[model samples]
Target: MRIRYLLLDVDGVMTDGTLYFDENGREIKGFSIYDGHGIRLLQKARIGVGIISGRSSTVVAWRAKELGIEDVHQGSRDKEAAYEMIKAKHRLQDEAVAFIGDDLIDLTLLRRVGFSIAVASAVDAVKQEVDWVTKKKGGEGAVREVIDFILSAQASHTKTPFS
Candidate 1:
């Protein structure tokens, strides 16, 4: 399958599944710079990026904007619906999509996409279903690893300018 779009799940897939709350009762999420650059790299390659997460966080929106990810669907319990929206939005087929996730909730979308991936620390069930499992944990360069894989898969055909 030729992956043209990369769909991501936050929380366990992007971060280490850790949630923090400050004294002000404000929620905080941590994102890795490596993942940020990975998003940028994908953007440079003209590959589409989308996020379908079950939780809705202001930080997630801000981070997506920072990384130039335009297709973000938050608070989506039924992720397959979100995936369909992206597929229609991009006019892409399931065989051209890659989804990376880490939990049971992500399994539905994972199974439907062409290339499903999981981070090294992902749940056993999720790892079992994925076509590829990264060596790094979430928010610790897992997304970057996937980006590299996609780019490498198309390397011979397209010379993407990666610095």
Candidate 2:
């Protein structure tokens, strides 16, 4: 099946599942440039991307904006509802969508999408249930690996051969 849209979780799937804070108690996150570029590739390929994280963060919003992704829905306690809304908004079927999740909160949508992914360091239960597992761990370019896979599968990649 062809996946035209992708939904992702933030904490464990995008980051290393670590929450950082300074003396001032400001939350900080580190993202992979490889992942950011891969997201751009997906957009260039005309594949829609969205975020459905349980936690809300300004960092995520800023990153999504930087990547030109418009379908972000953070702090979703009921991810299924968010999934349904996004699916309905795009008038897409289950077989055309993919989801990446790394925890129990992600199981429902993971089971619902046509393709499901788990990062390498994800919980064992999550890894076991996903359709694909990344060799790279989250916050370390795992999202990039998944994007490369999808782009290759869709024959949408246009990188030059480094011969």
- Using lDDT as the measure, the top candidate is 1
How does each model score on lDDT?
Answer: 0.88, 0.87
RMSD of each: 3.3, 4.5
Once fitted onto the true fold, the runs of candidate 2 whose alpha carbons sit more than 4 angstroms away are 156-163
How much does candidate 2 score in TM-score?
A: 0.93
Give the alpha carbon lDDT tens digit for every residue of 52-130 in model 1: 9999999999999988889999999989888888999899988788899999999998888878899998999999998
Looking at model 2, how many pairs of residues clash? 0
